[model samples]
Target chain A: MEGLSQGEVIYIIVLGSLGMFLFIAGFAVFISMYQKRMLQEQEKRRIIELDYQQQMIQSQIDSQETERKRIAADLHDSIGSLLWAAKLNIAYLGRLSNFNGEMKDSYLETMKILDQSIDSVKRISWELTPEAFHNTGLSSSIMELCSRLNGKGQVIVFKEKGNQLFWKDDRALMAFRIVQELLNNAVKHAKANSILVNLNWNSNRLLIEVQDDGIGFTLNDKIRNGVGWWNIMHRSKMIDAAIEVKQNHQQGSAIELTVPLSS
Target chain B: MNKLKVYIADDHTFVRKGMIRLLNTFDRIGEVKEAANGNELIALVKKTIPDLVVLDLEMPEKNGFDTSKHLIDHYPEVGILILTMHTEEVFILNLIELGVHGFLNKSAEPEEVERALYAVADNDFYRNEIVNHALRSGVRRSTEASSAKLSPRELEILLLICKELTPHEVSTRLQISEKTFFNHRSNILGKIGARGNVGLVKYAYQNHLLELSA
Candidate 1:
């Protein structure tokens, strides 16, 4: 070994170094493959977690719809009939008191108004409870309500811009309730003169957009802390849609609802 | 004197008919007409120019607000009264701006309506006490506008402005002079950090200055 030529020794050392480098490169490749495998497992677990969350949301929605239908039916069928009977009794009271002077007329008038208020509350209750909601599909129902409301202040423009708005029935129902509640907020809170609503199917998603030229507001405002905003947000979760609420550049607030048609 | 012509606008037929009966019981109310919805009421108001219009808040075609506003704009001489079951301050606040001359809950005693008819017909403001209480309660919850130094009178005035009222009309409602009303409006704008009329209206709306009824 000591008698070996200098060139031969140098060649040996270079070859040995190249071999060590190849071994390290091979080990790095193996480690990279191991890391990729671990990432794939984590992703699979994450997907499972997401699926569980979706199922839980769906269960909650199903329960909520069932509850709404039940409560609405109770109010419409049970309480409504009772109110009607009471109203009829008031009319009957008119028959007993005929050609009355101011005092008797006053008595009869009080009775009649008492009956009218009962009726008004029942109607509002029905609208809130459920029966009125189901009789009409969400779009037509909302349009009817807003159309009725438009007569109140400035014209509230309500229109659906898309062709295929049919969604998973639960999602549709929840979406309908959400829009109804938001419209209530607009009318009651925004002091909005004109409310413009847009609903449509965008690409593969069902989109609901509510914009108002009235007083626009940020979503995180304290007024949104109650059941109204909570309901809208929970419903958005049901359809896997992300709601982008921002002030419209012109003057108002625009709520953009984008829900995927497919899971 | 001739009877003051009266027309009724309410969604419920029973209520409208009841109102018609109540008004006719008095010799002061004459040629009582009835409309079941806002559209009918508007058409009737335009056609007849009734001395007094009694409208309900929740009606189809045109609601009480629109119908009343239309009547006020087109027939300023005719007194408009809002007879509603809800006496929420917010509703009254909104009505006040619409220049609604009289406010009464449907739950009011029959005499209240007759009194309201007389006062409104006489071109006087009748602020239902229940409504004031509701407004006071609603204001208590939203204090965002409290620090702005808006006097109670200014708040009442601010509410009317929100309904898109002209300053002249605001003067008539509050019994203030045109000059004072202008000065107050400017002061209100300055205090609230609002630029123009819209800005004032927007700030009032956002700060829950408008007594909003459910």
Candidate 2:
């Protein structure tokens, strides 16, 4: 106090305080910026992981579809041809007048069996990969599926609203498969007697709802984690579609899938 | 007895040939012609019209649906038999509406096929037990939405009516004036394409608007 000047002491204090303030301000800005960068990096990583998962699901569905098609082709071409040839040969033998009654009866039985086999093979192949799904679009194929499923007291009421939609082939196929899985679930698990399939086609979206008068489900993580629901969810994600499964308390379940119209 | 000339149109060689052979064996069928696709059938039919044309639904050039329409338009006299594997009610109903004479499954027995051919040729229409059962069940699946686009209030009134409530009782139950109730009832009848309350009840049952369980 006796040696230092008042002016020098004031200057020293002023400089020290200013330096401390600047340091604190700079540290605060650096921390906020660093935090923002870390948040952005986490978002990027999450997106990348999601994208990877979608790609894997898409590829998995594609490979399964390709395998099904290959098997269907094999069944239709190889086995179907053999059965037809066998039936045709039997028919030709039947035309021979020298054949005895017993031989003729045996030939007739063989032809019938061959016809049944041909029908079965066709059915199995068609079930695996529907020709209508490729050729006639989604609506007709769904109707075909409904008819096939609607035998033996189980009733499926199908209704379509608005003009027929023109959709991308792969997306349409995925949607069909998803609906098929839902229907199969209804039959196999839901114990549904009557199912209603309603399709509403708007200008910008196609909404399909499958409602069943069955023992509805309770919305739970376990339900979503099931293989059928997981497959549906993955397929829906692959096509950029949305799905909502509602379970009524009394006795009904409905699954709604909405797909945006391809621009 | 005049032999029946049949025209068979199918895309598959196996199905086409098998059907052709089966038809040839039938004593009722005199001459049988084959077409690999709808275009060929249309061309062949234009030249020499068969008594009946057995059609497949899915074909290359034109589908069976379009072929049936074309046949009905041009050759109205020819009996059109849909021998499709498609047993869907919508297909059957649409074809029936298009004035097809008969509907037969491909898996039909040879005897049943003969019966259908004969019945369709002789009569204006044919409905076997299979066709009859299918039509009955399929007709029950008529478009429920198309039958009526009603308001919630109107639907509530409809359920009341289906429950056999009198107009006065319904008006009281709904807390609406009798005149207002009558107005709603008229609107309901018009929307549902029903003639009166009786028709409304029938429509309600048919469209499943009346949930019996409820």
DockQ of each: 0.02, 0.05
Models, CA RMSD each: 18.1, 14.9
Give the count of colliding residue pairs in each prediction: 4, 0
lDDT of 2 by residue, A1-263 (tens): 46788999999999999999999999999999999999999999999999898788878888888898888877765676556545544664566455778987887788789878878887778778885455457887787789888974689999999977745387888888888888887777778899999989988889999999878765562375487777788888777788987656448789899987782
Question: TM-scores of the first chain across all predictions?
Answer: 0.68, 0.82
lDDT of candidate 1? Answer: 0.68
Please report the candidate that would top TM-score against the real structure: 2
For candidate 2, give the DockQ: 0.05
Per-residue lDDT tens digits of candidate 2, residues B1-214? 7999899887777777777777777778999999988999999999999999989886778999999889988897798888765555556655765667777765566677788888678644565544444445444445544546889999899888766566677889989998998799788867866544434544565666764432
Query: What would the per-residue lDDT of candidate 1 be over residues A63-89, giving only the tens digit for each residue?
Result: 776786676555543444344334444
Candidate 2 global lDDT: 0.76
TM-score of 2: 0.56
Q: Pairs clashing in candidate 1?
A: A151-B63, A162-A200, B90-B211, B90-B212
Candidate 2 residue runs with Cα over 4 Å from true position: A1-10, A44-105, A122-263, B143-214
The lDDT for every candidate, in the order shown, is 0.68, 0.76
lDDT of 2 at A31: 100
